[model samples]
Target chain A: MIVSIEKCHHCGACVGSCPKNAIFLNDLVLVFSDECNRCGRCVKLCPVGAITMEAKK
Target chain B: MRKIEKDIVVVGAGPAGSMTAKHAAKKGARVLMIEKRQEIGSPVRCAEGISKHWVEEVGITVNNKWVAREVRGAKIKSPSGHTFLVDEKNAGNEVGWVVDRVLFDKALAADAARAGTEIMVKTSATSLIWENGKIAGVRAQTYGEPIEIRAKCVVGADGYESQVGRWAGIDTSLKADDIDTCYQYRLTGIDYDPDYCEFTLGSAAPGGYVWIFPKDEDTANVGIGVQLSKVKHPADPKMYLDKFIAKRPGLKKGQPLEAVAGAVSICAPLDSVSMDNLVLVGDAARMIDPITGGGISIGCIAGMCAGKVLAKGVKANDLSMNTLQEYETMWRDRLENKQWRNWMAKEKLTTLSDETLDKIVHTFSQYGVEKLSVQDLLAVIKRHHPELVKEFEELI
Candidate 1:
């Protein structure tokens, strides 16, 4: 998952919505760690449409 | 590689930051306000309703340009459809206008710039600058370029995810119950009372409420805020909102124009909002109304207080905790009691069953009580529903 820094208002709606708790905010940056299962819960919960699932690298 | 200096640096050019910069610059303090987004207010996240009283109090004139609609009152509906309507004049600060948030935010930032405050957009503050264990400034990315801004005083107005507060060691984390996951749709072609804002309570929005704030004769911001802690199963506020719209015939007729989602902090103000040369304002300080989730007016009020205190501190060459504490004291004096009361009301409100909510609405309607206060609510319960008085006695 990728969070567009420009679109994110840093509300952290995605942080709490992540069931795996893989999403965390560090200094206003939304970081999705290795634990993320791509459930895409954060994407639907994000109010600003800042989060998107990127093809796995 | 660029380094800039100012007397005060304000992060986030939302209402709070602009107001803070405006006041500080008006007081002759050199202020720089920055916004991470390219525009001052884009991808609007608010319900956009603000009281006319505070708008005037903050010295901003309410004109037609940004005032989308002026509501005569608010309507509260229970799950069973029992309704109570409060007149605007009697509703105190909760009743007023639904604004164009983008224009309103731009106007505030313009005011700050007019007051000689330097403004920057597309600048993201990634970290705080600490000098000798005292807060000094921010390290930021401006237009994808690294830059450092050092200031005598720093104001963190960075909305709900306030990293500045966390970096400054002010615990900004919220309990699950203290937050609302919200989703809103700006719907046009809707049939709604243009003169009234409407709220629906009960299972439609568990632990929170659904609101229809009319923006025009045929358009409204239809939104729902669900308490994160109260959500079960899927735990998605959007799903709840979809269900709400699907059930309402009037809403079902409306065409969605834009969608917005965000989180709101519905907690009491932080225990402490200031440290050495650092202060937190707006949503960063959790200035949102616990029940209503309205923060524009409160955020502006707090911003003004911060600006005044920051200016004083800058003039005295004392940006220490002692001086910045005045901002905290001023905000608490102005808003703390009301915030705490609302938080208590929210705590109790979340526990009520839909049946009880229907009964409460029915009771209020029977007693001709539309606007609710702790005292008024207790009085009504004591008179008509005495059995519940013990449960709510603590509110009195």
Candidate 2:
């Protein structure tokens, strides 16, 4: 999952929605950690539609 | 990184952070408040409704600058459209002012600045600075520049998903049921009663409610809060709100002026809000009202409590957990029991079926029970419908 900083409002909805607690907001930046398994919980939870999932390369 | 020092550092410039900074600075402590947003309250996420009494309790006067409208009461509409009105005097903190949140928040930050607190906008606390296993300061970035600030005490007023609390090893995680995903629109050209705020309950908003808080005779904030856990399928809150508005002719004709979206934590207060030299205030401590999802007043009060305790700790040269724990005890004494009761009430509300909700509203209206208390509601049920009273017996 990738969080576009420009679209993100820093509301922290995605942080609380991540089941693995992998998504965190440090200062104003939303960081997706290695613990994320591409679960799309945050993608749906984001209010501004800032989070998106990408296939692993 | 530019190094700065202060007696107290408060993260976030919302009501809680600004109030904490204001009180602490007034006590002869050097306070600095940091906000990540360029403007203090640019994006308004709330319904903008607050009780008048609490505003006064925080020593903030009610004025035309921020108050959009003064409401006389609140009307609760059940799923069946049966309504009951509760007067403002009896409603207590349930209803009062439909405010301009942008102005209100900016005013609060200005008040803090006037009280000798230095405020930095567009600054975000990236992480906490720990010394000997206690929080000593914060590492943050101002705009694009890095800055390190050290303080005797750190107050985390950083809203719902507080990273400061997370960094300090506080479990800020909430269950899906305890969080409300909300969407709101400031609408005009609506014929709504400006004197009262209206709340609609039941399946229309599963596990939560919808509200119409009027800013004027023709302008209002139309919003809905749906419990994330209660949403059985993948859905957007906006879709539900749109469907709801489409059903009402008056609202369907309304034009959207502004749109706001956010999530609110609607759970009981955290187990502990203070550890070592750090203390959490407002939404960081989960002090929001579980039933109404209102936090402004409670947050301000908690911030004042935190500011007082932190100032005393600095004066005593002790920023230990023991000293900061005073804030925990003080806020608990003032707000804990009420918050816990509200959470319990919210639990009971979520389990209610739509038919049951209609029956409850019908009962309240029939009995002319304008002022609602947990005990009164239970008594009304017991007198009119004995079977239903058993289900709510625990609440009383």
Candidate 3:
């Protein structure tokens, strides 16, 4: 559930999408943290197609 | 490498996450908040406009450090240059405020930290840790090291760029028509009224509006929003804004201090925002007003609800799908129902022709219908256009 800064517009859409309330826009970057539960709601709901899911390294 | 455990863990550190943490911590829950950025608020993305009364409603403290200017009312201008003033009396007493968004967001995070929530910046969550087919916590990376977080309840506050909720399977997708592309600039040397929020609606931004929210007497946050489906000719927002400014006698000489581009979801609330042990708040849940494109007010309200419900679920040791249902029900009761009505109206409005819009606005003004309800407006439209009644009937 890592965020892609380039795609993000800071609309605050994903901030409310998290059940755990895990999304926040910090300056120019949207940050996701340890509270995320892989709900994938934010990934599917981004208005400008800013969010995506990548496999763990 | 780090391993930590807590009663409630909130992700993203944005308004929703911070608010949730604040409330949950106020209730005596051990709260942990994480962010991928070094600072809480930076690189401003919003139009920086917010309703004035939001402070009292969301129980937020008023801080002069973030507020750029206090607005008295909203003045809406039609396509043909016709204007209508929604004065403070007709509108709300204090309509809104133009803010320094970065400062505002940092204040929120600071509030949460002051409430006893541990905030970790420059941290990222990679995936959810599952246990018995339900989310147990998150696997995250701080700096370059791996860390595992285990908590009874987890929250996603990650913003429009959220993947945490999607990973949990809530179907947070938006249609092209349901979303808006926005562009904004922090302009200085602009001589505009600092007490009024101005909106120019119609051809300038089909299916959306252009706004000038004052930051001060000499500066303002100027922006425009357009529905993705109505975007033709690939026009840039800043270009349109500059052209508009050039035409205005007062703003032709202003200097742009910064540029911002973003998008907003004017869609209705989602069918669900809760999973077994996870909850989606703010933009992830799609709890935004379709007409105004405002979410901070609703997001904070929803966060309060999520925080309270989640705390109860954790206390009962019942952070399961059934238990988390309370979060969704509470949110709907508080805001989703109203947001859905607005979305329906937005759908009807988007399909309207320019002439029809002009006629409607003219008729409303002529009828002296200064105080209008969304439901009443939709009813009026349906009565006159029966053939299109089906489109707007749901609004009633």
Candidate 4:
């Protein structure tokens, strides 16, 4: 998942919904690690839609 | 890396973290609380409304420094504008106060400091340290400097996205059905009444409700929460809230001072909040009320319960799940029924159509609520719409 920093609220909502526990809020920055399975749950749970799929390679 | 040692290390300096640290420290346990933020209560992520009764119960002395408005009651409005007024005088619940969240959080942290908790700001827990096949301490960073914290017990008071609990192998994850994504704006020049907090139900907020919590006569925190499963588009909560504000003549001219976004979990009480040397408190433990989307009071109460057991475990030199089970028992005895029952009620409320919402509110408006509970609501509907009680009876 890719987080649009400008739109991100840093609210940590995505961090909780990530089934793999791949996301963590680093102060204002939202980090998505390799552990993320691209479940797309965080994209939907994000209040401002800050997170989105990184477009399948 | 510098090494710090303590009996307990609480991650996240929110109300829950402060309460746990305070209670445990007062009991003679050396406690340390770490916060990622430079300030204790910066980046407000809550509705800032807390019921008054739990404050005294948990031994929090109210100070005018944090209170913004003391409300007598709440105004629950249906989609069609039908109103059910419930105040402290009649309702089984106590009245509440709208607070300046930043100040309230700081005051709580200050109180914990007074009780002898060592607080470190701009210090973040990066991961948990495991030693000898058991829970040990935390790996943290102080500013840019890496530091290691060695503790006998770890307390996860982190909020909705509690990483500590997950790292401890606890399932604190929320599915779309259990979480509500929220968006809020601190608006000025509104028609909101300061004496009563307002909540509008129905399609305006899909699975959740739109709330107007006043800061004063001219300003208020206007927000909306929607079930994640019900969100069909990007920024659905903000969309719904803006639509509601546009339709309201009273709020049409309101101007926003700040925008805040958050999420609330309205799930059933977790299967466990403690194990071995680790304990979870507050939102990290899914203590939020399902029907109200409120967690401040509930979190504080659980923090106290967890604190007592946390200290005892340290003193006894037993941080095993066996010793920490006292915390689980205390919280379950006090809060299990309410959280479980409200989760059921929320499920029923979410499936309700706007028309049914109008009916429920209209019926409730006639008598007003004596107590806020699923059973009480079903009883009232049983007296009026006998058929309505059937759908809800299955919940009980």
Candidate 5:
């Protein structure tokens, strides 16, 4: 998932809903690593709608 | 190894999945829906804003219990703070409502259940079952144990990252450039009319826009979206939102009640949504509207379409790639052209600088172009900014 620091609101919704714990409010934005399962729970739980699914073409 | 049988298996319990189950049940078909989440709509996404007309078109019953607020118009704010009120005359009759999405989604699922569709929560479909080159059923894990469910047909109503569709051998990947990153908040104790939704355009959000949808006189859902490809400075949306909120006299003092963030696809592909014994709906098929980032309406529509087509296939005792192709045609005929055009428009609009946007907003305001449809607005731009007009003309 693409976590844009500028677009994050630190809602914590994404952090709570990520099945694989791929998101966290490190500074302000939820940061994810290559370990993400791409389950999309974080993307769906976010009220502000900031995180997007990113996969290699 | 446990085996169960059903007429149809629907993966996911979002709007598309529920609607697919509902319509199939209405046709007297036995439908089973599996949702990975324990509760429907608990982890809320989306602004919960939808046009009233789409509900009416789908023959859904509207009630206050699920509606957060009703709106009759929209206001557009340029990056420089110039505002344009899209009067009711141009906003269309069904400007719509900001909904309690959790409630609305639950109600839709409830409606499907009441119509005889069986729902199983906390279950995930792990893979698709194929026999002799045709889909036969799905291998699912429910409550942490492996279980097999056989079905005549399977409907993939799963969202953007649809594993079921992927397992079914349908290509569902979205290009990084085709997606949007968005953020939203439910603010209470805000002072604003509950009758209008507000949109802020231009530099506030690159390649996207910001919206304030009122849930009540003191509460609203406000957020912003920007294209994934255009993040130059790459400022987090929250920082920009804070600045915007700090500047907005109406919202600066409002207390934020709840904050949520998520993503939605703008250019979801539908060409490969169907294959043998399986069809994809909603974000799995990438059926979202490219311009507005709205998918609930389109997802529901796709669900209903998939349901109808799947039912016909089952009744005819044929759920092959050929039969399911009917759904592909139907949805494409209905939405593909428009969505493709909207995607083009989105691309063109995203390329504009904030200054150009301000000029467009100013010119539109001066011409009272809020009264015109988006197509008409393009014509106005065509007249004055002919060079820019070419971009939009091609989109149309």
Candidate 6:
């Protein structure tokens, strides 16, 4: 998952909604860690559409 | 790395943190409040609406700088557009102020500072500092520099995304059904009644509702909350709110000035909020009203209770869970029953069909129910539509 710095409001919706507890908002930066299973709970719950799925290289 | 010592250390610096610090400091416990953000309140996330009664209860004077508009009443509409007005004079604290949350947060933090609490900005708590396998303080950082704060009491006043409680071995988990994913826009150039806050309920926002809180006659905070369980698409909350606004004649033409989003916990009150030297308050404690999804007033009240209890425990030199249990009992005695009642009602209400909502609202408009609340609605239903009362009685 990718968090868009420009669009994200940093409100913690995605951080709280992630079932795996894998998301964290470090000040202005929204961090998605490897603990995220791509269940996409954060994607649906993200208020600003800041998070999107990316092909894991 | 720097080391600091205080009688109390509060994390988050929001209303709950500041209130705890303010009251604890006032009672002579040294207090320090830390915020990860450089500014106390910005990039506003709340709907920014609150009842005024808690201000006086929390001993905060009404300050115009933070009050955007003093609403006189609330106008509720069902899916079919049937409207019911609940006037403040008659409804008591049902409707009050549409505030500037940024200014309000700053004011609370300032109040804490004035009460002799030390406040640090750009600091974040990384973990709990443990001693003898029990909580002692916080492992934190200022900007990028690590620091350890050793305190007798630690407060988890962090909001929805809080980790402080989890770090303390407190369970703060939520089911998807218990969370509300919200999106809002501060829209200007709309014709709005500055005196009345408005709400639209039913399938427009499944398992939740849309609200319009006027900042002024020409501007308003228009928002929608969709139950996380009901969201089936990416960005469903924003989509739902946009579609709702696009259909309203006056709202459709409004231009966006700001955007806000956050998750509101609409679950039952936690089983406990205190453990040993640690206690959680505000959203961390799940002090929000499940039906309204409003937290400011209730959270402030919880903060006041927390502040009093923690300070007393500190002064007694016993930070054990038994001592902290006083806080648990006090807050639960005052807030738990109501929170549970509302949670139960919300469960039943969310399962209701759009036609049921239209009918219920239509009846409310016709019968002229003096106030609108879960208890009041149930009472009215018992008096008039006795048969329908059973649908709600099963839970309450």
In model 3 chain B, which range of ten residues has the least summed lDDT?
Answer: B363-372
lDDT of 5 at B196: 87
Clashing pairs in 4: none
How good is the docking of model 6, by CAPRI class? medium
Tens-place lDDT digits, model 6, residues B239-291: 89999988988989999998888899999999878898999999988788999
Writing each residue's lDDT as its tens digit, candidate 1 over A1-57 gives 777888776656776445565777765788888989997666655654577889888
* Of 1 and 2, the candidate ranking higher by DockQ: 2
Query: What is the TM-score (0 to 1) of candidate 1?
Result: 0.91
DockQ value for model 3: 0.11
Each model's fnat?
0.22, 0.19, 0.11, 0.69, 0.16, 0.75
* Tens digits of lDDT, candidate 4, B1-396: 799999999999999999999999999999999998899998899888878878988879999999999888889999999998988866545568999989999999998999999999999888999999898999999987999999999999988888899889988877788999999999998886888889999999999999999898988899999999999987888889999999987787899989999888999999998888999999999999999999999899999998888888889989898899999999999999899988988988999999998999999999766687678778888889887778788764
- Cα lDDT of candidate 1 equals 0.85
**Model 2 chain B: lowest-lDDT 10 consecutive positions:** B230-239
Candidate 4 positional error at A44, Å: 1.5
Candidate 3 regions exceeding 4 Å error are A1-57, B233-235, B364-372, B376-393
Candidate 4 vs 6: which has more TM-score: 4
Task: Spell out the clash pairs found in candidate 1.
Answer: A47-B261
**Is candidate 1 or 5 superior in DockQ?**
1
| TM-score of the second chain for every model | 0.97, 0.97, 0.93, 0.98, 0.95, 0.98
User: Taking the tens digit of each residue's C-alpha lDDT, what string does model 5 give over B1-396?
Assistant: 888899899998989999988988888788999997788876787888888767866657898999988888788888887777776677675377888988998999998899899999988887888888879888888888899989999988767656676677666555546766667678777777778888888878777889999898888988887665554433355556777788877788888777665566788455678877888888778788787888888888878888888888778888887788888887788778778877877777888888888878877777776444558778777777777687677644
Error of 6 at B283 (Å): 0.8
Evaluated at residue B315, the lDDT of candidate 3 is: 77
In candidate 1, how many Å is residue B334 off? 0.5
**Interface RMSD value for candidate 4, one decimal?**
1.0
User: Stretches of candidate 5 above 4 Å error?
Assistant: A1-57, B232-235, B370-372
Q: Count the backbone clashes (under 3 Å) in each candidate.
A: 1, 0, 55, 0, 20, 0
Taken over the whole model, the C-alpha lDDT of each candidate is 0.85, 0.85, 0.76, 0.89, 0.77, 0.87
Q: In candidate 6, residue B169 scores what lDDT?
A: 72
Model 3 lDDT, residue B354, Cα: 64
